[model samples]
Structure formats: C-alpha cells, structure tokens
Target: MFEISPTEWTAILLSLRVAIIATLVATPFGIALAWLLARRNFWGKSILDAAVHLPLVLPPVVTGYLLLLTLGRRGMVGAWLAENLGIVFAFRWTGAALACGVMSFPLLVRPIRLSIEAIDRRLEQASSTLGAAPWQVFATVTLPLALPGILAGMVLGFAKAIGEFGATITFVSNIPGETQTISSAIYSLIQTPDGDSAAGRLVLISIVIAMGALIASEWFARRATQRLHGN
Candidate 1:
C-alpha cells in the first residue's frame, strides 16, 4: 500500500531539486535583506519589510498570479528578458523554483533577521576597533553568530518549498518530469482512479520530510541559544 512508483519517484526527486535550488539561490538574498532589516533604519523601511512578508499574508494563488503577471511570457519583465537574454520562466521548472523561492522567502528571512538582531553589537564594534575591515568583521563575527538562524531559516524555507502547491502549479502548470513536484503529483493522483495508494504514500513522505525539518530546526535553535549564552 505504501509502494512508490517510478513516476512518483520522479515527482519526489523534482520536488527536492526545486526546493534545493530555490533555497540556495534565495539564501544570499535572504541574508542580505535580513541584515538590512535588522541593522538599518532607512526611509521606507516599513514598506520594505511589508513587501518582504507580503507572501506570508497574501493567498498563495494571489501571489502566484502576481508572479505570472510580472514574470510570465507576455509579462513586461519576462518579455524583455526573453527577448534579450533568452531566459524564460513561465511553464518551466525554473519557474517552479522561482515560485517556491518567492513563497518561501519570508520564512527564510525572518529567523535570519531575528538572529542578526540578537547578535552582540559590542562584538562587532570590538572587531572593528581591532583594525578589522567592515567585511572582515561581518565575515568573522556577524556571520558566525548568525549561522544557526541561517540554517534554521534555510530548513524552514526548504520545507515550505517542498510542500508548495498553489504558486508552483499556477506558475508552471505541473508538467510531468519537468515541473511536477510531490505536492502537485499528489494532487493529480487523488483526482485519478487507483491513485489513492500513490497519494497516500506521497502524503506519508511529506509528513516525514516536514517532521525531520522541524526537528532539525529545533536542534539548530537550541545550539544557537546555547552558543549565545556561552554554554
């Protein structure tokens, strides 16, 4: 009853690939934005924060629709990129990754921002006073201290990406072997005859992956707290 067929395996592998690519590509941006939000107090900061977290509050379908309008084949930005750079997003696996990344970005940034905020400014100041350049201080002090949060955020974002349904499907249309993820595969399975068993198996897989990610997040959080407390 729990057997996973080759097609299901394909969906599973594709989901993993999309999630990984999304998380990796979004991490640096997450870190940079996190630092900005945590350390800076510029004009329109609140607006930027709200924009960053918009996906969290908006319906997934709405977010996906917005992405389509902005990045679709006929979209303003999309058309330009396709015409000049030959890059396409709509109806592609890369589109799925983009949707996942955008959807998971809020989750990716929050913990990182909190972690950066929790870091000791005095440590940074001391490093700077010791002739370390700004980049050196950030690399040696800020980044090390924020590693736990970054890992936690990445795990959270990855888990979210793996389960993403509405945005990814809306953007990429769930093409098998190209853009089909586990969630979309499960959705398709449940709509077909004799697909219950496959859907159930995928559901179990999703549960396991989510539980593992949460566990890993907890472990990282604990380690972060311990390190912060000098234990």
Candidate 2:
C-alpha cells in the first residue's frame, strides 16, 4: 500500500469530525422525533414524517443546492446569522455538517422510531400509576427500553455522515482542511492524473470506516438489548 499523504490525513480527520458532529447533534432530535411519530396521533402526522424523511428520498445534490439557497450568505437565516453572530456556513465545515446532518436525519430517526413503537405501553401505564411523571417515565422507562434502537440509529447516522458526498460537495465545495472530507477528497483525486494511488488508499480507509461503524453498531445494539432485557 502507498503511504498516506498529509492531505489525506487531514481529510480523514475532517471526515470523522463532520460525522461525529452530525451524529451527536442529530441523536437527541432523532429520539424526540421518533417518540413523537411512534406515540402521538396528530393531524398531518404523515406529512410530518414524509418531510423528515425527504432527504433520504430526494437527490442529495438537490438537497445541497437547496441549502445553498436557504443558507447562503444572502439567504434568509444565513443573512441573519452572519449579521448577528458573524458566522457563516457557505464553504465552511459547519455547513458540511449541516448538510450531512440533514441528509442523515431519517436514518437516525427510523431505527429509533421502530424501537419506540416496540415499547410496551402497559409498562408506561404502570409507571404512571406508580406516580412517575411523564418525563420521569420517559427518562427511566421508555428511553431505557428503546436504547438499543437509539444506539443503532446513531451508528447508522454516523456512517451516513462519513459517506456523505453530494450534499457536502454542493454546500461546502470541498475546501481542503475545512470541508474536504474523505469522500470528497477521493472524488477530487479520481479526477486527476496519477491519482489512483491516493484514491486507492482513501477507498481502503472508507471500507475500514464502514466496517468499523457496522461493528460498533452491533456492539451497542447487543449491549443495550442485554441491559434492557437482562437475558
């Protein structure tokens, strides 16, 4: 195998950073959304679900373009943020994380929703009868019982963030050391001459990362399941 370059190393770090940011920020919202979808009956619920999952079905490039329009310097929230907080997302790593997070939200929500749905309602009722507040019941009972699916969802979101390309490149433009994640770096290398070596190295890294994510997800899932069931 060829020795990895500093550029590649930076890209690796950036990729991990983006994935971690996306997963951590999205996980809490994922759990909340999952709970809402699983336990609540409200008007336009189907529409809410579809809107949340839109990124999964829509073209990632299209999603990126939309972000550019809505989050660009002159765009609505973007303009306010720049004016008030002096922050920018256009061509920034934060923008890359936003794109990845939006794209991976559905993946994080799906498994969590399934787990929430699987929870036995009788347990929650019994907790309520025993004088546990709703928040207490959720924190102690529903959340604990649904931990396995939440873990799975987080892992899946991280994997998706690591592999995110289209929306990231569209929103962040693949600036080295800022937004040039592994997937974007690989794409950049593949477009030039004598780039095969670097591309190959990145490809291997991608596989390893993917496999590692799968292994981690399995580990968390099993551990959570065991903790919940104690069998």
Candidate 3:
C-alpha cells in the first residue's frame, strides 16, 4: 500500500531530524580531525587514528553501552552535566543524535582525510611563500580544494545516521515520537501481529531515502570533478 500512517510519518520525520542534527554537530570536528590526520604528525597519531576508526571495528552495542556508562543520567560525565548544566542524554532524542554522531563519525572523516591527503603540498608551499597566514591558507585554499570530499563525508554520515539502529536503540530505548527512528519503528512493527504490511512500507521508505542520498552524493561528486577540471 502507498499509504503511510501517522506513526510512520513521525518516525520518518524523527529519523531525518536525528540524521541532520548528527551530521551538523559532527561536521566541524570531522573536518578538524581529517585535517589533522591528513596534514599533521604528532604524538599518538596512530592511536588517534585507531580511536577514530574504533567504532567501525567494535560492535554497535558495545559502543552504545559505553556511551550509556559515560553519558547516562547517573554516569560520571552525565551526572556532572546534569548537576552543573541541566543536560541529560540518556533515553532522549538528543541521546539518539549523540549515538548516531559517534557511530557515523568515521564515515564523516575518511573521505575528507583522503581529499586533504590528495592535495598538492606544493600548492600550500606556494601560498605560504605568498605570505598567507596558516589559517587563511587553510580557509581559502585547503578547505576550498577539499570541499567535494567534505560534502561527500557529510552525505555519508547523514546516510549512516539515518539507518543507525543498534547504537540508537541501545542508548535511547526507542521511545516513540522521541527516539524511535524509522529503523526502530520498522523493527517494532515486524514484531506485532499482522504488521508485515507496515514493516514492508517502512522498508521501502528506507530504501528510497538511502538511494536518494547515494544518488545525490554521486551527482555532487561528479559536479565537483567537473568543476575541478573546469569542464
């Protein structure tokens, strides 16, 4: 059936909201980390790289449990935040966003790192010789040249956030109209009697969203390539 129920619509909207927030919140940090990995050498560089990528290797449930321990209401950080700042993450949509952001962070960093690594150092050297400040050089030259990769990273992160399930449900417990995302809703639907049709609809919607994001990413990548080549 082509009809989507109100609950399904809520889940869809909530998924979009969480994905967008996660992407926006993670982007600046992603760029900075990508730049560091691409352009700088430092103590514990390997450790940092491994840490950034740890999520990809670890079970999502483990990540979520770790987050709960560190950021739940009674957690060390969470308690301090709640006491001092009235902020709470456990069982909240904000918590879902945080979980999504953490899970997708590596996706947001890899493409940008590759792009930055691909940049010609000679171009940077040339800019420095022209007396451009480091910040100015990065803002004007490095960032612009790396825009395509940054965009790609954002899209990838967004897609990852949209589909995130294990971490989100573990951290926030899939509360409807709050933390219940499309994936979680579909999961709930699948467990109910005669819920196959609703579950199927959600699956179709998920496919459409994922495909759209992939198409957009590819189109943007092509456009960026064309622009780079002055086509």
Candidate 4:
C-alpha cells in the first residue's frame, strides 16, 4: 500500500524542486515588501499592500488565468522575453514555479511583516547612531531579529507551493516530467481508472511533508523567541 512508483517519485521530486525554487526566488521580494509595509509609509502603500495580498482573496483559477494572460507566450511581457531573451513561461515547469510563487507570496509576507513590526525601533536607531549606514543597520539589526519570521515565511511558502494545484495547472497545464507536480499528479490519478492506490500514496507523502514543514517552522520560531529573550 505504501509502495511508490517511479512516476510518483518523479512527481514528488518535481514538487520539491518547484517549491524550493519558488520559495528562494520569492524571499528577497517578500522581505522587501514586508519591510516596506512594516516600516515605510509612502504613497499608494495601501494599494501595494492590497496588490501583494490580492492572491489570497482571489480564486486560484482566477490568479492562474491572470498569470496566463500576462506571462503566457503571446503575453506582452512574455512575448518580449521570448523574442529577446529566449525565455518562455507558458506550458513549462518555470511557469509552474511562477504560479506557486505568486500563490504563496502573501503567506511569505505576513509573518515577516509582523516580525519587522515587532522589532524595537531603538535597536535600529542605536545602530544608526553608531555610524552605521542605513543598509548596515538593516543588515545587522533588522534582518537578524526577523530571521525567524523569514524562515517561517519560507516554510509556509514551500508548503503552499507543494500543495498548489489550480494555479499551477491553469498556468502550466500539467505536463508530465516537467510541470506535473505532486498535487497535479494526484489530481490526475483521481481521475484515472485504478489510480486510487497511487493517489493515496501521494496524499500520504504530501501530509508528511506538510507536517514536517509546520513542525520545523514552529521549532525555528520557538528558538528565535528564546534567543531573543536571552534564555
């Protein structure tokens, strides 16, 4: 009952690959946006925040369709990239990664924003008073203090990416050995004859991975809290 086939293994590996790439690629932007939301009050701040979080409120299929419209081969930016840079997103694994990253983006921002907000401004001010540049103060003070939240956000993004289906399928169309992630594979299995066993195995694997990520996030957060408290 627990035997996983080669196809299942492929799906598992692909899911991991997509989730890791999505999380890493999204981290820097997530941090920047979180910092902006938490610290800077500029024009259109509310609009930017709403845009970052629009995916959460929007249906996954709707998000995926929007990506298709903007990132598909014939899409404005997509066509330019394809013609100029030989890059394409439509019907490719990279597109799957893009979809996952966008879907998981909000998850990656919220915790980091909260962490940045919780940081005592005095610490940053002290660093600034000590002749540190703004970037240095952020690198030294803000980032270190917010590490736990960043880690948590990454894990959350990975989890969301691994489980993403609607957006990925809609954007990339579930091509095997390329865009077919575990969630998509499971979806295919459920629609196929005598695929129940295989789908069950994949479901179990998904559960294990998600649980492990959650556990790791909790541990990291707890450790960070302890360190912050000097305990």
Query: Whole-model Cα lDDT per candidate?
Result: 0.95, 0.93, 0.92, 0.93
lDDT for predicted candidate 3 compared with the true structure: 0.92
For residue 94, what is the lDDT in candidate 2? Answer: 94
TM-score of each: 0.98, 0.96, 0.96, 0.98
- Total clashes for model 2: 0
lDDT of 2 by residue, 1-231 (tens): 679999999999999999999999999999999999999999999999999999999999999999999899988989999999999999999999999999999989998998888787999999999999999999989998998899899999999999999999998898999999999999999998999999999999999999998998888778776866668
**88-157 per-residue lDDT for model 4 (tens digits):** 9999889999999999999999989988998889989999999999999999999999999999999998
- Cα-lDDT of candidate 1: 0.95
Candidate 3 at residue 198, lDDT?
91
Clashing pairs in 1: none
Q: Give the lDDT of residue 160 in candidate 4.
A: 94
Task: Decide which is better by TM-score, 3 or 4.
Answer: 4
Task: Rank candidates by TM-score, best first.
Answer: 1, 4, 3, 2
Give a tens-digit lDDT track for model 1, residues 11-125.
9999999999999999999999999999999999999999999999899999888889999999999999899999999998999999999999999999999999999999999
**Model 1, clash count?**
0
Q: After the best TM-score superposition of candidate 1, give how far the Cα of residue 173 lies from its true spot, in angstroms.
A: 0.7
**Candidate 2 accuracy as lDDT:** 0.93
Residue-level lDDT for 41 in candidate 3: 95
Model 4: ten consecutive residues of lowest lDDT: 222-231
